[model samples]
Target: MFEALARFAVRFRWLIVVAWVAGVAGAVVGLPSLSSVIQTNNAQFLSASAPSRQAADLAAPFQGASPAATAIIVASRTDGPLTAADDAAFSRVLLAAATITDVTSVRDQGTSADGQAHRALIVTVPNGPGNAPNARLVTAVRDTFAAASAPAGLTFHLTGPLAQTADADTASTQTGDNIRKFTLLFVIVLLFVVYRSLLAPLVTLIPPVLALLLAGPVIGQAGQAGLPVSPAIQQLLVVLLLGAGTDYGLFLVFRMREEIRRGRQPREALIAAMGRVGESITFSAITVIAALACLAAASFGLYRGLGPGLAIALAVMLLAALTLLPALLAIAGRALFWPTRPAAGQQSIGMWGRIAAGAIRRPIPVLVAGVLLFGGLTAGLNGFTTSGFTSSSPATASDSAAGSAVVAIHFPSPTSNGEILLFRFADPVWHNPDALQQAHQRLLTAAPVSALTGPLNPNGTTITAADITRLYASLGPTGSLPPTPPAGITPSLYQTYRATAQFISPDGRTARFDAIPAAGPAGSRAAIDAIPTLRTTVADIATAVAATDSGVAGVDATAYDIYTTSTNDLARLIPIVLLVIAILLAVLLRSLIAPIYLIVTVGLSYLAALGFASIVFVHHGHSDGLNFIIPILLFIFAMALGEDYNILLMARVREEAHRYPLHEALTRAVARTGGTITAAGLILAGTFTVLAIAGNNTQAHQLGYTVAFAVVLDTFFVRTLLVPASAVLLGRYNWWPSTLSRTRTTDTPPTSPQHGPPSPPHARRARL
Candidate 1:
């Protein structure tokens, strides 16, 4: 089948090349920009049934107060309590800030209790679903603050949801060009070094570049059809195409060179090479694609989004590796390796032949050493922990994080983040308004909740919830109170009553309040984990208030849902990924035992990589713990990519074992494919290292480093030392349940690998 495909590709080489070029051009000109579709808000990525989303639905009428695009400007006098003059500067800044485009309103929330700070709310209509408007508004607000005159001690910090998103967006955008340039540059240099030719690297690079260009728009279309596109996902596609896709190119190219050296002309060599390694490359890509496609089963919207887009990318890469790559090689011919030409006749497999022979001879000790080394690393899993979605200090620092710190000191809330608590009763709550107090009191003492503010305590002090109904009856509706205080109502009491309207629905059946979460960053793992207990408290509060419904909504609530869903996604989907990959291996190798042990080796590599990363990021690094997303990503990439090498080496082993003795075939296979796999691993690892240095956040660092390390470990240790030794020990069982197992192999490879004369395959027998 591969031989037929190779013939078609080479026969229609120009047509294939032209079609790939046109496809890339069409994607660039016709499709939506990848950035245009990137998801901005975390909550937007949640399922409609998520608790925070449900809370958002119940609070829809209060959207005016709970604007999606909102920020807080915290003004404080660093040296001491804020004075009247400092307050005047804040007033000016607010007035100037209110003039920014998309800004709906700006209102002072009043001074802090200690008089050291003040916060003002800036609300804006979301111009679009992403960060462009938010970033523009943030910049305008910062400029407004910068242009203001105040005491040198006076400072203004723009913090909260809007500012944080913009800062993160900007950080990711800054790293985009570097991720591409360094990834490409690294791959070219590595290929050039390995092939020892000027043109070979360029020829090898075309498929990955074309794959990268075409995959983005395809994923964006998937986003249009209803998945989420993130800047990180786009960047990951670039790295994956260059790193993993190019590996298939190396496999075919190296094999073609070997075929040419065995007396096949350029066209014939290309055909023979593609025919031989095509199944290996095909299975290698399928392994990656299968693992990624399994992400669709994940309940987390982010993982669901990731699974499809990345799977599409791997598919594009596979098609290019199998079709366009060989076509390009077919056109370029032997000149692709200019300045060096293949010496005709069978040649030695060099140093790796001796190493393979030694490991094959001492299979027991070699396998034991490999297991013990990785086993020690696997134990580092004990140190593994989670830091949650976002950390206070990420690899990419933002001004908003710094501002939040100052805001914490100025306005010492018990919780670092706040949640919106909503209650709806069977009847109008104004009729038995004291239930508002019952709910508020219950929440104030709740361990993970504090500083409850609602209809009963609007302005940080208790008020009669009935006074709210009475004031509205006397003045106006809950949302529209009299412009001024009338007879007998003191100004402070009138102000409190006006503040109370937002908490109580006009119909009076529902109520809303700001329930400050317990003291920790909203994105912390502990904060996410604490959500279940907090929800229990809310349920208990609902029962005490006798309300029909209750829930908490905010960043913490959304993060909790995503965190739990991601974990569930792994447990439910990982087994499916393994089963699918094992099935592919069994079909490719035609042996059930091979798939079982192969998956076991890949699993060990996955754990060792993650364990080492845990030691670096969780145990020793500045991180509170490794980000929760790292382990899942490591497993998929390692299992899939680790199998890439496994498939290639095993395919070569199976091919050679057809004619040579089992031990000789094992040596020849390792010696033959060693350099290509090594070069492939280096190129793949270098691209990931580029991401670790160039990506925008700490999670990227952990993810990049872990995958890169796994690739290297697979290249040098598992594929080279462990698998070969184990194969030698297994003997004929390596091909059990297949015709290859029963075949008697008398012939062997050349003995003096570096200097032996080429011998006919059926007649030669090699001695170790």
Candidate 2:
């Protein structure tokens, strides 16, 4: 099959080149403008039934009149009560901001508990579903706010989703620039070392660069088509395409060169190399695609959005490797290795070869050592803890150390619980005389409430006239409270409330309960589990509210709904991915035994990677835990890449076994392909390590370190030592009941034979 492919590629090399050119041109012409949004859509991030989503739905109507951005009011006074002059100046600043095109309203002003610190203004911007807060508007607001001269001894601080998103975007852009610059340098230097030829390394990098170019436009179109792409997907695509794409390209070229060294013509050598390596490449690509596709099953939109893009990128890379790469090699001919000639009578026994030799000499020792090393890394899993959105933001340095510090000092808790609970009043009952009063009573009495407001509506039928109206009004035009709600109701009521209930329907048919976990940061773990407890409380409140003849229906049960749903989806998807990988390996290897061993080795490598990541980021790296999404993402990438090495080593062993005994074949295969596999592994590892330079944020750092370490271990220990050792141990059984054994037996040479070429008499005598 590979020979035929190689022949076709050589015959139609120009056609392939032309097709690529046309494809690139078409993609460029058809590319859509890239636009992205950074909003915390609870349903998108969490689960459909999450309290946050429920609350959002209930609050929807009220929110329509409110600003999308949170307003942070800072008031620092040097002395007595704030003067009228201060109030007048602040009001002018806020009112001026309200006139901006995107600004919805600005309000909330009062005095703080200390009297010396007075409450200032909060400006709200319109944020509607599907409509992101305008960056220009946000910047305008910030600039306007900053320019406002506060009366002497007053300072202001701004912190909200809008500000955070802007900061994160800026940080990500800078990080991307750094990554692009550093990665270019890294790839160039590393490729040179591996190929030992500047031209060869440059040639090797082409496929990946082309793949990335193609992937970008395609992903842009996907995004426009409503395929929920997260901005982070772009970064992942770049890293994977470069790393995995280069690895594949190098593997094929190296094998082709090896074949050429054995005296075959360039065309025949390319054919033989493809024939031997093509299936492995296809299988490896399938593994990666399948793993990424599994993410589609994730409950979070982020994962679901990323899955298709990654799968498409991997598939394109695979096709390029099989078709375009072969064509390129065929065209280059003997000069592909220019400036360096194939050494005469030279037997290359590189570092990997020596390592394999040692492993072969002491298989058990090698296996034991490898297992123990991996086991120790896995132990770090104990310290792992999950973090929130702030932790994921690239709002600070390469590692986001400064951002993390800021969060710790000023916002030691989850920035906002992002949890919501919804209530819907049965239609007919909403008009009932007692409906509004009863609902307010239930909300006030709810177990989670630290404070309560509303039942302020006199009519009690219309949503705007209900108790929620007073609450919204108190939050002011910016949706934030004054230091204290006018005397009778302290402004702290909104902030202290476990759940802020609001009516959404104009007819008073629906209401929302927004809740913050009372347990705080130290309580996240317990809170994550106790969602059921919160749900029960919510249910009880709903029942009480409904009894008023208002027919209030529970829209959301608890914050736990989001967490549990995602956790469940992750649990289900992981096994499905593993099963798919195993089946693919089985079919590719055409042997159940080989597939089982391969899958086990890959699984162990994944666990080891996760464990090691946990140690560095959680224990030594001092992070709360690896990013919540890291395990799944790592599993997919690691397993896919691991399969690449498995295919390379196993294919070589199978081919060599056709001539030599199983033990000797294993040794020969390891020696011959070890260098290529090692080089490929190191290149892939180095590409991931670039993330370690991401600074502050541990997500990139942990992921980069884990993958890089896993690849190294896989190449050196698992592929080089364990695989060859096991293959040697398996002996003839490795071939099973196949014709491979039959062909070997039938092709055996006679005991005695005359040489084709004449040798010196003395040399012939010495050999005899």
Candidate 3:
């Protein structure tokens, strides 16, 4: 099968190249916009099973009037402490903003205690087209306020839920673009360095570029086919295709060059090279695809979408590597090695042969050294903390950070990082105001709450519980209260009475309030840790009040659920990926023993990489902790892509072992393939290094660096040293239960009592 494909590619090189180019161009021109698919994917990051999704469903109706929809604008006074002029400007702006659609309630939260800042709140209807709020609406509000004239010496900032989402999205998009651009540039330079010929690098790069162009459209179409696709898949595709495709190119090209030096012409050499190495590349791509497919079992919609989307990308790359890359190599031929052309003769087994000889001769020392090195790095796991995944807030460099600072200044209440708490009952609580007050009092004492805001504490201070009942009587029946204040009631008091309609449902069966966690912002490590305890207290309050249903919603609750789901996914998905890849290894190598140890080496490599990342990004670096997704991503890429080298190296070893004794075969195999693995590892590592440098965001940097470091470790250490040494120690059992294992004996084997005979005279002559 491999020889057939190679022959067709060599015979029809021009046609293959043109067809691939046209196919990629078609995908680029005709497919759905990448951004549209990303937006759709972003809206579904949480599955329907998540508590946040359920909470959003339960409180959908109350969302319109909820203060949780509110935005805050802080007008900082530069000339002096804020005065009446700032207040007047604040009121004028507040009224103008109120006219904006979905702006439910606009209030001057008023001057800060320090008297240096003034704040006004603008509340919009929280519900948008999908799961998230309308971030575009925040842009509109922000632009309106920025366009409006403010008091002299006042600088203003617009910030709230949707504003935050908008800012974060902007920063992420910019950084993602930078990563793609830099990765492309870096890969070109790296390939040029690796090949030394100008045209050679370009020829090598065409396959991966074509694969990348085609992947986006395939993923978009997959989304249309009802496959879950993550918005983040596009960012990751750049890393995988460029890295893996180039590795495949180097695999075939290096061997082709060697064959050319061994007296074969360009076309014949490439065909021969493909015949030898094609199976390795095929199995490598299949291993990565299988590993990624395991993510389909994840409970988090984020991971579930990521699995098949990435798998689709690898599949496209596999096709290009197998077909287009072979054609390019066939055409480029000996001229592809222009600056350092090889003359026709047999190639030498030089540097790697000597190194491999030492490993086979002194396997114990090499194996022990590899183990100690990896073990030392893995000890960095001591600092690993599963605090949570990344947050939607922009980085410190973004405008959102400026807005948060303003919030910290003027809106310095304990509830600054709070959640929206809601309770539903079969009966209305307005008539039974005491039950409402009782629930509130219990939350303050029993829950993690530092403060609570609801109908009973409308102005952030207590209002008598009995007055709530009396006030409802004066305001008339449910949903019938006059918009205007009646006689004997103050206008401010009337607004409070009207607000009760918002805090408690107009139908009067449900109530919503705000509760500030004692720990801090929902994304903060401490706050994330405290959510389980808070939920238990909420349940206690639910049972005591006899509420039919209740929930804690907003950022904190959603983050807690996401973290829990990711934790479970890591636990479940890791074993599934390991089993699937182990099976693939077993079938490819025809050895159960080889599969077990191969998987162990890969696991060790992954864990060491993950721990090293924690040391870089968490323990010593400025980041609070490793992003929860980074470990899972690091593990997948390390284990899957790392196996590419494993397969290539081991397959060569097995082939050589068929023709020679075990120790000599291992040594020769390493010498022949070592240069290829080194070049491939360097190119793959370069792409990820560009990712690390250009990622710009904390989580992106962590992921990029971790994977790059892992590739380097596997290239210089595990693949070069650990795997070969362990293989020598395992001996013939490496191909257990297969004909190779039954018939192929080691050079020095006599452990079995029945196997102690000398060879016949003809057999001895055949060995010579």
Candidate 4:
């Protein structure tokens, strides 16, 4: 198949070149008019179907040109009561905000107990689905607030989801721009260094650039077809394409050069190179694509969105490497290696040659040394901790740091917080006006509830509206509210609240109860821990609600559904991905033992990557921990990438083993292939290192460093030392029962006699 492809590309190289140029130009011309829809993972910002989409749907009925913008109002004072003058000034500021063009409704303005501090209002601004936040309106509000003076000794703080989102968007854009600039510069320099020729590096970089340009249209079309594309996909695509794409290009070029050195014409060399390396490239690409595709198993829209996009990018780069690259090489001919010809009669001998020869001489010692080194690094895995998504943002940044400061001062922890809770009742009995009023009063007195609305229905059952008002409410005039709720409602009411809190079916048989912790929304260890308690509370409420009538079913009984589902998903999906990768490796290499060792090495590399990142970003970097997705993502990249190296090195070893005995073959194979693998590894690693330059979030930084470190370690240590050492020790067993052999056959070139090259100078001197 690769031979046929090479033939077509060499036969019609110009057509391939023209097609690429046209496609890239067309995409560039078309992508600019594209929509700039800023999406986020926040459930409140999307609909229930997908977190962002569901949030949008829920906010639809609020009546606006756009969804309302959320705002937090904080009132603080030194000593006196919050006077009428202060209230009037604050109200005027909010009222002035309503006059802005996109302004729709402002809700929930009120004073707190003791009158020393209060929450005056929440500002809701009109926003369309997928629209950028109304920054103009927010600016106007800020200006209005700044212009208004509070009563003497009073101060106010204003912020909310909209404000934070707007700030994040601006920061992310700036950070992305900076990242791109630095990444481009770094790639140029790094590639130049590796290839040692400006033209070769330029040629090497083209496929990745082409892959990225093509990916944009593909992703856009997928989005149009209703596939979710996360906001982060664009940035990730750059890293993914450059990392994998460069590796593919390097493999093809290295093999082509080797073929050229073996007395083949340029066209014949290109075809031979593709024929030899194409299968391995395809296998490696498939493994990576499959690994990324596994992310679709996640319930979270974020993962689902990224999975297919990354898969598509990998497939595209693979296709280009197989087809477009050969065509380009055919056209360039030997010029692909311009300014530096292969040295006359000289051969490349890499570190692997020395290591492999030493290992074969002392296999046990080498094997033991490798085990100790890997084991020592693996020990760091014990310190690993899962990080929250929001924690990816730099804590020192204005929005993130300021937000953290506010939460620490006014609440418990950020992760333990909930923004919105919806409830349903099982029976019409509690929907009665009086019963509903009682339920509302009960909710108001519940431990987690800060404010409760008047009952809207007249049944014995109804959904209660409780705002986690304390989240936005300021410190009391004296500083901090008592931890416990004041006594008023009965134990039955508390029990009923808990029972009805579960997200129950619409039938009067189920009820839902919800609580907003003092912290903000999203995942955290604290959030994970608090969920069971919240579920228990809801169960208690459901039991009480059920007592009202035999027909009543506690509908809202599953408050921990999202958390439980996500955790269960991670456990199930991770193993499946690993198993699938192992199977692919086993099949491609045709060796069970080799696959096992390769998988283990890759796994250890992944663990080391994660451990190193955690230490740098969490224990030392002062992040709470590595992001929850970091470990899984590292697994996919590391395993897939590690497989790329494995295939390259193992394929060379198999080829060499066919011509020589086990020990000599291992040494010669490592010598010939090590330089190519090292160059490929360096280029791929350099591409991923660009992520650390992304300043908008810590996740990118951690991901960049983790992947780069893993690639470097895999190339230098695992591939060079561990892999060759094991191959030597395994001997003929490495190929299993395959008919292929390590012993030289009649068809093989002579090892010591007169095949082609002249005898050494020492032999000539002896003859003289």
Clashes of each: 0, 16, 0, 61
Best first by lDDT, ranked: 1, 3, 2, 4
Name the regions of candidate 2 deviating beyond 4 angstroms: 7-22, 25-29, 33-43, 62-137, 140-159, 265-268, 343-345, 383-385, 389-516, 545-562, 741-768
Overall lDDT per candidate, in order of appearance = 0.79, 0.61, 0.74, 0.60
lDDT for predicted candidate 4 compared with the true structure: 0.60
Model 2 per-residue lDDT tens digits across residues 671-764: 7778888788887888778866753356667767878888887887789878766665555555555555444432332232221222344664
- Candidate ranking (TM-score, best to worst): 1, 3, 2, 4
Please identify which of the two predictions, 1 or 2, would achieve the higher lDDT against the true structure: 1
**lDDT top scorer:** 1
What is residue 290's positional error in candidate 1, in angstroms?
1.4
The sequence of per-residue lDDT tens digits that candidate 3 reaches over residues 317-375 is: 99998899989888887778888877665454677777877777778999888888889
Each prediction's Cα RMSD? Answer: 4.2, 7.1, 5.4, 8.9
List residue ranges in candidate 4 displaced over 4 A.
31-38, 42-105, 111-158, 391-524, 545-566, 618-622, 741-768
Model 4 vs. true fold: TM: 0.75
Q: State every prediction's TM-score relative to the real structure.
A: 0.88, 0.78, 0.87, 0.75
Tens-place lDDT per residue, model 4, 141-212, is 677767777667766655555555565556666766676667667777877776676576677778777878
Cα lDDT tens digits, model 1, 567-670, are 78878888999999999998999887788778888888888988898888877875777777777888888899989999999998887776667787778888
Q: Which stretches of candidate 1 lie over 4 Å from their true place?
A: 63-159, 346-348, 390-416, 426-431, 455-470, 474-508, 516-522, 746-758, 761-768
Local distance difference test, candidate 2: 0.61
